[model samples]
Target: MSGLPERIERGFAAARQIADAVLLEGYVLYPYRASAAKNRLRWQFGVLVPPEYTAQGGEHSHQRTECLMEARDGDRLAVELRFLRVQRRTVEQATAAGFESVERLELADRDLVEWDEGVEERIELLVPVEELAGEGVQRPFRLPGVGETGLVHERDAVVGRVIRRREQVDGLLWLRAEELPGPYRAQRLTVEVENSSAWRPSRHATRDQALPRSLVSAHLLLGLEHGRFLSVTDPPEWARPAVERCRNERTWPVLAGPEGERGVVLSSPIILEDHPRIAPESLGTLYDATEIDEILALRTAALTEEEKREARGTDDRAGAVIDLAESMPPEVLDRLHGAIRGLREATGSTALGRPEQPWWDPGDDPGVDPERDRVLVDGHQVGAGSRVLLRPGRRRTDAQDLFLDGRTGIVEAVLHDLDGSVHLAVTVEDDPGADLWRAQGRFRYFQPDEVTPLDGTAPVEGTAALDGAAPVEGP
Candidate 1:
């Protein structure tokens, strides 16, 4: 609601200059943290240059450029060219600025300590964008919903808030917005169409009305006070007329539905909002309540004994060990087995068995389905598969290494990644080479024509039942 600040304008100017020369380049200016005091304030910055900047015959050859600016109280302005590390202040000078605590210089794990331990501390900086970019920067840093010029627009249309974002079970992102407040909520609704495969939110609105690119305007919608609205709300002052016009005329194309089978039909007159130039980080916090609530609901659900064991990354049960043994390499398997043995020894258990199973019970089938790679133990489906792997030891580059393996089955699941991939319980027949099937995360992206849908192919009944009171089995 407030106007853009002068500092932001200046920052944008500096950012533009840096981006001009190093298009697609990235830079960071971190502030220094105080060592001894909880509320210590220090100024320090770290510059990051992309590898492209140092490629042969590249424009810039510097590596990890750092600058220390003078802590001028009244006039806060600084700029530097490509080559130099702008020296803001020395250790002695920093002391004069009230940095006297020697313990402040202490680091956590001193593995790779670098220079400037005296004044070097990682801090978040609020610097001018242009200064952050260095001089002559042109390209904009595209983050989250920001655009090429750090401005957000839809179909060249500008509205107020993001009212609704419908992320379908099939990986589709649909957004609906009403114009800024003016009229009743019902009359203000306008749809904004964005095709995932075709459109990027960063595309700028052009003057050329005939171009298909221009068809995707940056329409605006007003966010309610709490930030989220599933249906619709009144338009803000700037959007009253536009929202009314859109509603009455049924202008924008929204709600993409099936046309026949291959193509999709979208209702027209997509509504949108331009991102504010300068706003508080919490301005749009209310809009994410729905997503946050959904997440909480998922977290609150109870896990079965097997589910809890797998969740804890433990191999106390035969089912879980089976899952691990099927997926892990020999060395990793040995390490895991040793860990389990150590745990059993420490707990005074003679054998490694299901954590929840009785000491005399080893035949307790946890209901692990190795053929389908789904583990239903103790009446609950233990785990499922995911698209992107985010395990602690399994980074993206680790490929399919991010999997929940058990004697009965192995399910690939995501730990932290946010790709369109899902966590599903899939069945594999005798053919381990058969196309991997996933079922759990609502999406069913079957490999093209690999398996036809049949009545029995749906998830087996009782798949959702809680796993409870099953006899534990030993590994």
Candidate 2:
């Protein structure tokens, strides 16, 4: 394999070429939207690269990104290349856009809903509306009305201009409404139902039935600081009555709080016959009093450093950096951190679409590979190392790198095939430690003698391959 300097040299060469063909081409900046909290307003600086520079994706061929405005109105601001895709636009249009086309990108500051936290803990739940029969209300359809907040249900409710008739032959009518232009043109009006069929006629008794209970529903817009809790239901059927009643009144069932209420307006108002609504039996009405405290207790429980790391979006690098930082002397730590930051910036300059990895130069070593002798996995022999074949990175479907730890004989076999290719079958032992380094995949082949000496000694030539193709795909 080529040495570190060679790999980095090639990577930088490619990045420069891409920069010349794309980044220097320039782009245009346009105002988008501002955050409700007024912390930032989004803007887009569109850059049109030549047809040759477009990434291989559909409409995504053109990249789109959001940037924070430095001032209410300013021409100059830091930008990052966010959306990098190819769009079919004339070169003249692109050149006319008066914005620096170099490094036109920015990082997103939004936190997505924690859907990946766990299946048991949902970020949001929908308590769909349903119809319930009432006195003299044979065709009673609930209308929440546009721009109302919270759920509201009245047993014998009457709403004029109910555009949607309930599909149920004998079930209660369900009507949904969205914001529309009013007669005055400036006011918002309630239009027809969104999807009337989504509401079903359900009874309170069965497990899947929508219970018969008066309810007030609210569609909450949650912000970062606030949270609401929905306790696990002992008997899920308790939710039915609330859902049914919400349908009668046209309110969305919701868990609300001060935090979730931040900078967010409810889609509709919740109006039950009574000012304060009663909890349904399905929600374990009694537990409602204690559920909040229990949730608070869970939140207050002590957590390990690892758990805290997860909360901050730290992965393997975080632990490594922390562990390494803690061991360094105070003065050395500062220097090392600064150096690390610089390294990160330099490496980031050669990322995807950038010319970090350059075209192959025939004059370079072109490297050499030793014939594989024996292959073993978990102690049992698989085949001769020469019999294994591997196609490392650069190719679309090829494996990148391979790593093997000393313990547990993680890599038992390294095989070479008749076609002069190689493969390594690994067998990992007991569960690995959080700080453990498992076997790494290998792209280029090297002699064992060439690698053993370089492990801890002074860095040698071709050490870049030992570091697993850094500049090619640096962190």
Q: Which has the greatest lDDT?
A: 1
lDDT of 2 by residue, 1-475 (tens): 1222332223323332222212211121101011122212111122212122222211011211111111111111111111122111111111244322221112132111111110000012111111111221123223231221111123443211111111111113222212112332111111111112133333333211211111111122211112112211111254333223222123222222222221111222322121122222111111111133223222323334433343222112223333342344445423322222233334343545564643443235233222223322222222222222222234333233333323222333344445644444433335354124333542334322212221132333444345321111110
Q: Give me the overall lDDT of model 2.
A: 0.23
Location of the lowest summed lDDT over 10 successive residues in candidate 2: 113-122
List, residue by residue over 172-246, the lDDT tens digit for candidate 1.
112222223433332222222221222222234321211111111111111211112221123345444453344
Write down the TM-score of every candidate.
0.18, 0.16
Cα miss at 242, model 2 (Å)? Answer: 18
Candidate 1 minimal-lDDT segment of 10 residues: 24-33
* Best model number under TM-score: 1
Q: What is the lDDT of residue 351 in candidate 1?
A: 52
Model 1 Cα shift for residue 320 (angstroms)? 49
lDDT of 1 at 336: 25
